[model samples]
Target: MKPVFFLREALRALKRNAIPSFAAMATVLVTVLVLGVFIPVVQATTGAANEVRGKVIADVYLKTDAQQKDVDRVERVLKSEPMIKSVEFISKDAAYKTERERNPKAYELLGSNPLPDTFRITPGNPDDIAKIKDALAPEAAGGGRTVIDPAIDEVRNREEDTNKILAVTGVVKITMALLAGLLGVASMLLIANTIRLSLYARRREVEVMKLVGATDWFIRWPFVLEGVIVGLVGGVLAIALLAVVKIAVVDPLAADFALIAAPDTIDFPLLIGLLLVAAVAVSSLGSGLSLRKFLRV
Candidate 1:
C-alpha cells in the first residue's frame, strides 16, 4: 500500500493513544538530560588535569644578594640547553609582591622581603627535567645561592598527584557511560512496548481490513507508521531537553571553569547528529515491535 493511506491511519492511531505517547516522550527527554550533564563534567575535569600535567615548570631560587649579571649569565646558559623549552627570571621583589597579593594577612606582618630571586624553567619532558637538575646542582651547591632542588621536587610530586586524579576520573567516566547506555536501551524498550500495546488494542479492526480484500502490506503499514510517529515525537522531545540542560546547567559551570576547557560539553554538530540518529533508531524499533501483532509472520 502507498504511504498516503497509511499516513492518515497512523495519525488516527496516535490521537487514540495520546497519553501513552506522551509518557514515552517524557521518559526519553529525561534520559537525554541525564546523559547531557554527565558528559561535560567528565570532559572538563579531565581536560584541566591534562593541561596542568603538560605544562610543568621548575623553579631555581638564588641568594637574595646574588648579582644581576650573575643571574643573567645563568639564564643565558640555561636558554642554550637543548632540553629546555623556556626559562623565565623571577626577581626577589616580584616574588615578594606576588606573595603579598596572594596572602595579604601574612604580608602585613612581614618586616622585609623573604623570597629569593629565581628562574622558572620549563623543560621538554620528564627526562629533560632530570637532566637540568643534574646540570644545575654543582653551581647551586656553593657559597651563597639558595638551591631550589626541594622546590623542583615539590613540583614533580604535584604532577604525580595530578596523575592519580586522572586515573580516578577515568574510572568514573567509564562507569557513567555504561550506565547511560543501559538507560538509553531501557527507554527504547519501554517506547516499543508502549506502541506494541496500542497496536494490540486495535487488532480487531486490522483483522477486518485484512479480510476485506486488503493485502497484508496494506493492513500492516498503518500500525508500523503509528509506531514510527510516536518514536519520532520522543526523539524530538529528547533533543529539546538536552539543549535546555546544556544552556541552563552546563554553561554556568563552564564559565567558572574556563581554564578547564570552557566548551567541555557536546558541540552543536555532534548533538544534532546524535539526536537524528536516536530518532531514527527509536522509530525503527517501535515499528518492528508494533507490527508483530498485525503481521502473520
Candidate 2:
C-alpha cells in the first residue's frame, strides 16, 4: 500500500471512532503518568537518604599527626572488613580549628588549644561498627591518648535505627515502582483489547475487502496506522498529566528531599519526548494485539 493511502485511511478511521479512541488514550495517559511520578518519587527519597548517610560520622576517632603509615594502616583495616566505603584522617590542627569556630568562647575559656587530633573511621560493615566500637574504645581509653571517640558510642547505639529507616524508605520506592509497572501493563492490555473490539465491529468490511482481492497490506495498513495515532495521542496526554503532577504534586514535597543521589525532577521537554516514545509503544502494542484476531486481512 502507498504511504499516503495508509495515512488517509488512518485519518478517516480516527474520525469515524473519535469517542472510543479518546477514551483509550485517556486510560493509557493515566497509566503512564503513574509510572512517571513513581520514578521521581523513589529517586528523591533515595537522594535524601544519602544526604542523611553523609551526616553519619565514624564511631572511632584516631588522632594522627600526619603519620602516613598509621593513617594508611587504619584505612586498610576498615576497607578489608566489608561495606566500609572509606576512612579519612583529620589533622589535630583542623579539628582544633573547627572546634574553635563552633564555640566562639572556647579560646577564652580554655586559654589555649585543648582539642585533640582524631581519625574519622567509617566502618566497612555497618554491623561491624559495634564490634569495632567494643574492640577499639577500650584501646583508646587504655592507650591513655588525650583524644576521645565520641562517635563510637553514637554509632553503637543508633546504627540499627538508621538502617531501619533507610530500609523502609528503600522498600517504599521499590513497591511504588512495581505497582507503576503493573498499572502500565494493565493500561496497555486495556488499550489493545479496545482496539481489538473496534476491529471486530468492522470485521464484515474487512472480510469483504479480502474477498474483493485486496492485498493484506492494503487492507491492514490503515488500521495499524490508526493504532499508531491513538498511541501517540495517549503518550502526549500522559506527558501532560505528568507535568501537572510534577509541578503541583511532587515539587513541594520533593524540595527538601531531592538531595545528592536523588533522581532529578522531571523537565517538561524531556517528559514530552518520553511520552512520545510511550505513545509509540502503546500504539504498537495495541496494533499487534488487535492484528492477532484480525489476521484475515
Candidate 3:
C-alpha cells in the first residue's frame, strides 16, 4: 500500500526478530569498521611506496676534460627523451664542494677537484631506469662492453639498489591490492549470510503472503526497508566508533609521528561518507538477493 505501511512492517519485523536483527546489524558494523580503517592505511602505504620510487634515479658522469658544449649537448639529449622526467646538471666544482663539506679531511689531501660533471636523471617511471640507462650506453651487438658518448665517463644507476627498492615497493602494492579485494569479498558474503538468517527466520511469513496472491514487490519492500534501516544504524555506529578511535588514539600518535600525520591520507569526512554508502548498498543488495529464493514460493 503506502510507504508508511512498509516502514511500519519493517520496524515490526525488527522488533519481532530482535536477536537476528542485532546479529545482522553487528555484522554490518564490523565490516564497515574494517573498511573504514583500511581505506586510509592503503592510501598512506601507497603514498610511501611512491615516495621511495621517486628516489630511483640515474647518475651520468661526464668526462673530467669535457667542455661546456659537450655537457650542454648531453643535457639536451636527456631532456628530449620521452621517458625522462627531469635532468639536473651538477658541475664538477659543485660536486667537489659538496663532497668536501661531507668530509673535509678527505679533500684536504687532493690538489684539485677529482669529481666529474654529473647529470642526475629522474625517469617518469622507476621501472624505466634500465631502459634509460641502456639507451644512453647500449651494449655491443656481441654482448661486448657498453658503448658510450666520447664526452661521458660513465653512467651509474645503482642497478642493484634500484632493483631492491622496486621489488619491495611492487610487492607491497600488489599485496595491498589483493588484501583489499579479499576484504571486499568477505564483507559481501558476511552481510549476505546475516541477511539469509533473517530471511530464514521469517520464511513462513513470506510464503503466506505469496500464497495469498500478494505481489513479490509488495512482500519484498518491508524486508528491503528493514535491511536499509539495519545498515544505516550499523554504519552510524561504526562511524562513531571510528571517530572515537581517531580522536583518542590516532590524533595523539599523529601529533608525535610525522609518518602517521602524512598528508596523503583520505579526508575523514569523505571516508565516513563512503563507508556509510557502502554499508547501505551492501545491506540492501544482500537482503534483496536473500529474499529472492523465498519469493519463488
| lDDT, each prediction | 0.64, 0.64, 0.91
Q: Pick the candidate with the highest TM-score.
A: 3
Ten-residue stretch with the least lDDT total in model 1: 148-157
Clashing pairs in 3: none
Off by over 4 Å in 3: 142-150, 260-263
Q: What TM-score does candidate 3 get on C-alpha atoms?
A: 0.91
Model 2 whole-model lDDT (C-alpha atoms): 0.64
Clashing pairs in 1: none
Residues 1-297, model 1: lDDT tens digits: 568878998787678777765665565555555545555555555555445545556667666667777677777777887788888888888988888999988988986898788788877763356556656653444553333333322222234654555466556657666876786677667656665665677778777776787877676677667655655666666667777766897568667775434524567668656765675567656765566667663
- Write one digit per residue (lDDT tens) for candidate 3, span 1-297: 589999999999999999999999999999999999998888788888888999999999988999999999888888998999999999999999999999999899896898999999999999999999888888778875463678887888888899999999999988998998999999999999999988998899999999999999999888889999999999999999999999999988888885533748898999999999989988987888789999998
Q: How big is the positional error of residue 18 in model 2, measured in Å on the Cα after superposition?
A: 2.9
lDDT (C-alpha) at residue 48 in model 1: 53
